[model samples]
Target: MTTAVAAPFRFFSLRVVRTRRLGPSLVRVTFAGADLAHFHSHGHDQSLSLFLPAQGRTEPVVPIELGDGWWQGWRELPDDVRAVMRSYTLRALRRNPDEIDIDFALHGIGPGAATPPGPASRWAARARAGDPVVLLGPAVADNRAIRFRPPEDTDLVLVWGDETAVPAATAILEALPAGTRARAWLEVPHAGDVQDVAAGPDVEITWLTGGRGALAEIRAARLPRCERPYVWIAGESGRVRELRRHFVQERGTDRRRVTFVGYWRRGLTEEQLRAAGE
Candidate 1:
């Protein structure tokens, strides 16, 4: 059920141990597995690939037995039979029980939905204890997948993320040292989607919901003066690009000091975005 995919990254057969509703539009699913004994991560914005069971299946179907060829094998499977893969952030990692928490951003999942829920959203909304899944995750700490790296001379940290990036942004904020000065903007669909983040007083968090967009709010506010500020932004592709430009070209921040990741696009599914190499 588990197989090594590459150095520092491998497949782990896991099952949902519990689920909690973090907000109106977010759910936290905790997963555990014996395979987690080898799992390791530095935790700040750690990226993970989760494989959910295909429709009408009890467990995910990933051709891990093919070893290094599993990617091609899985991709070749019929759409209805292949496992649904989605990228997620490591919200929290726990010891002793070898469990990891992944926060899901629900969309079109409940009653009165305006659009059909995607495979991942549907699965997470109904996920139950003992539901089987698989994860392609890190086996070594400090892996490249953790992308919120600030330079040693960083004096201030700026973060912006939509609901999709909330987990990563919160994790980054919580991981900051005591004296770190950080400001964050988290945007969600509904006011009920805003959740409490435990961070030091030096970290100021702004929650945007049902109103102004992140770019507009950020542009209207004045940032604290700092010689070297590291900016991390993630959300819709177009929005992320615009924010990156604002920081690099308008704000005069060094391009290297800004880390921007597009968690999703406005009108594209993750698969489509990947296929287009976005």
Candidate 2:
């Protein structure tokens, strides 16, 4: 299945209340607003669509005012006025304060740099307190985009991801029940990108720096014996596919029990990737 399933999505205007660096390449932006009170998110790998404005613009130009056919209306807009849309995981949600936290991975200009400049990365780098943006997310708590649902009879959980998928994987780790057995492999561009993650007692996490030999590393690692293991993997498109193959073919995992998603592709912008249906 795709990374995000259909849900009743509504636009919420969120203003950045705070921003901080979580690591060498990660920035945590906290948002709050009255409209956020209607924002309900189910925590395990819950995804949201962020609409960012053009450089120098204060807010995204969302044509949601057009009608229920907002997506079509957005496409009809002039290029300069249309917002830049990107999908991100809901890192943390606090209902009492009407706030949400999202972790952005900055690439190209800092430690663990990779690309030249990206729309989301540029916006994140320049975002400050009080900056406003729009998000398309669930209006209710139970939504299909929250895709960390393991079978009720699951015995073990296996997860893998690169830096881009860290926040979602972290959320999944946090949601695992106590005494649940889980093993996670995370790949980041630099050693400093690895942050401490809190999870259940039986969770074992391995962090790989630079992601140079991550495929080989995971292939060499052995999974714990379990009758019904639910596996999740996400990251760069090529690597994600390779790891999915490792699980399905090499490890003999049932394809139906594995959930794999390609968060991004190396050499393509979100626009290009989406256009090509990657």
Give the top-scoring candidate (TM-score): 1
**Range of the 10 consecutive residues with the lowest summed lDDT in candidate 1:** 107-116
Residue-level lDDT of model 1, residues 1-278, one tens digit each, is 57799988999999999999987789999999999999999868999999999998887999999989999999999988999999999999999989999999988874345788898999999999999999999999989898898999999999999989999999999889999999999988888888888899999999998756877888887988899999999978888999999989889999999999988988789889889987
Candidate 2, overall lDDT?
A: 0.83
| CA lDDT, candidate 1, residue 130 | 95
Give one digit per residue, the lDDT tens place, for model 2 in 1-278.
Answer: 01122356678877899998877778889999888777777757888889999666677887766547678888777887888899898888886778898988887756635568688888898788988788889877878777777888999999998878999999899888889999999887777778888898899999987656667887888788899999999888898889889889998889999988888888888889878876
Clashing pairs in 1: none
TM-score per prediction, in order, is 0.97, 0.94
User: Among these predicted structures, which one has the highest lDDT?
Assistant: 1
User: For candidate 1, what is the lDDT?
Assistant: 0.91
The superposed Cα distance between candidate 2 and the true structure at residue 265, in angstroms, equals 1.4
Each model's C-alpha lDDT? 0.91, 0.83
